[model samples]
Target: MTEPLIELKGVSKSFGSHKVLDNVDLTIYRGEALGIIGPSGTGKSTILRIMAGLLAPDEGEIYVQGVRRDGLIEDGGDPVGIGMVFQQAALFDSLTVEENVGFLLYQNSKLPRSRIRELVKEKLEMVGLPGITNLYPAELSGGMRKRVSFARAIMSNPDNPSETPEVLLYDEPTAGLDPIASTVIEDLIRYLQSAQGVCGTYAVVTHQDSTIRRTSDRLVFLYEGKVQWQGTVSEIDSTEHPLIRQFISGNVHGPIQVAG
Candidate 1:
């Protein structure tokens, strides 16, 4: 976890005139579960997008495995594979679970349908989801859909091992789930960080307290387009940092201005 895998140096971005990230410097070290948390409009997700190379920073530089990325992912591949799990699961509504999980292999690889199906099944089972491959996204519950997305994010062609993602970026992974469901997702996040799991390094942007506390070894609190505070999960409770204190306690009378 001491080695840096991805780094954002003086990164800033804006949509129109509204600034999101302002010269924010952040890093994700290898084999670390890093959580990014803040209020709704704080650009946490934006940071994840930039990390995934889905969006180019308006200012500043992004490095993957110490090499500066020149453009968006479409321009060139990073030194290591990076995968993303979107907030909505982002599965094709018409596609079955099998299709959704194996979509990448199906589109980009010459692997046989049987091979892809086998790989899909293996991933599904890895996420504790089995025998639901024939079902559509609509047929699954919120948590089930999330697990399916997890399977998809970790999917890689056995023929091309380098294509496997070394880092995963998760955006609001447990947003709409109930308490129990949220716990399930949180558990899965930690599980995937284990040696038996596919991805050991990941950055999660989440608002759920349990998800943040359970999945993250270290956390960075984003507010007003900058990283205001950062520390280990255990340090959260002991710190008197106003922003983090206010956020954790859900106090409306703190420095955070609540939007109407």
Candidate 2:
């Protein structure tokens, strides 16, 4: 069997005394899409942060392409190859789309300004926002901002040319968009996986059922700081797990408690 592109073993994290992730183990294979679904505050986003090396787990280990991740950059475990798309788009208000997409290249790469502009245009076109390089983030719609963020995440190549990022971490990619825009983001997610063929694997954290169903080849359900159930999207509809049933049906009762 092929080794997983990303793996988490007995991962546990806590914010003060509140335990968020408890002994979580997950594996993401190359060329596969993994969807993570859970109620709010269930550590779904925390998982993404940990995988991206943005936050360290109090316990357990994370391995990217078989390399163990530990400590800060000075200690040698820097967030080198990983690409992250935040939930809010997180674009710079002062910079134009071109600057936003090429921000990493400008900061990290020693490439000339002219070459960087050419590369930025190529990436913008890849995300379907070609010719809008001069537009500021405030000028574009919500969907367009998310696409710009997407373009930025993929702007850099890591040291290992053959293992470029290999993993894409997405936190709520479809949130705050209308139905039409949500669908567009969903299609773009799939397109990135199919067309670029560079990300190699991805893990998406979302609560939207349609987004989950349309994008995931595998599903993981989290609750009360741990995974409650896991299976394929097709298997989700047939699941007998009460938490899965309640979440999928949008039921207020059953295994999930809505706090007052």
Candidate 3:
């Protein structure tokens, strides 16, 4: 069997008196989109943060492409190389859209400024915002800004030619957007998976059913600080697991309780 691109073995996390994750194990494979879904505050985004090397697990181990992730970078660097799209669509407000998209190449690469500008325009067009490269973050709408963030996240790492950051993580990519905007982001996510010359595995954290259904082929339903269940998208709708049923049905009461 082909080895997984990333794996978490008996991973656990806690903060003060609260235990957020407990012995959770998971795997992500190449060229696949994995969705993480659960009630609020169940540690969905925490998994992404840990995997991206931004946070460390209190116990257990993480592995990327067979190499272990010992903990947070001792030198404050990303050893595994990952791309992240934060929930708020983190972007530099002072930079133009072109600069934001091509920041990595410009800052770290020996490429000429003219070539970087062309690459920046290409990425912007990939996200369906072709002509807005000269604009600043504050000038774009929330969804457009989010798209720009995506362009930045997926840009090639010019510092290391062989290290393209084969993993991408998204934390609530569609949050706070209207339905139409959400759909646009959803299409972008799909396009990225099959976009020519783009390659990687991705994990997405979301509470939106549409996002889960449209973006993920397989999904893990997290509850009580564990991967309670996992299956294909078709199975998610058909499964009778109590919490999964309650969540997919949007029921007020089930095995899961909402935090008051």
lDDT of 1: 0.94
Ranked by lDDT, top first: 1, 3, 2
lDDT string, candidate 3, 143-236, tens digits: 9999999888888755464546677898999999999999999989988878876655789999998999999988998898999999999998
Q: Model 2, range 1-260, lDDT digits (tens) per residue? A: 46677788999999988999999998888778999999999999999988887888899988877888776323564433678899999999999898889887777777788888987898788888989999999899999999999888877533335424567888999999998999989998888887754575788999988899888889989898888898999998897989999999999988788988
Q: Model 1, 173-248: lDDT tens per residue?
A: 9999999999999998888888464879999999888988899999999999999999999998999999999999
Structural similarity to truth (TM-score) of each candidate? 0.98, 0.94, 0.94
Evaluate all candidate structures by whole-model CA lDDT and list the values in order.
0.94, 0.84, 0.87
RMSD, every candidate, angstroms: 0.9, 1.9, 1.8
lDDT value for candidate 3? 0.87
For model 3, what is the error of residue 88's alpha carbon versus the real structure, in angstroms, after optimal superposition? 0.7
| Collision pairs in model 2 | none
| Residue 231, model 1, lDDT | 97
Winning model by TM-score: 1
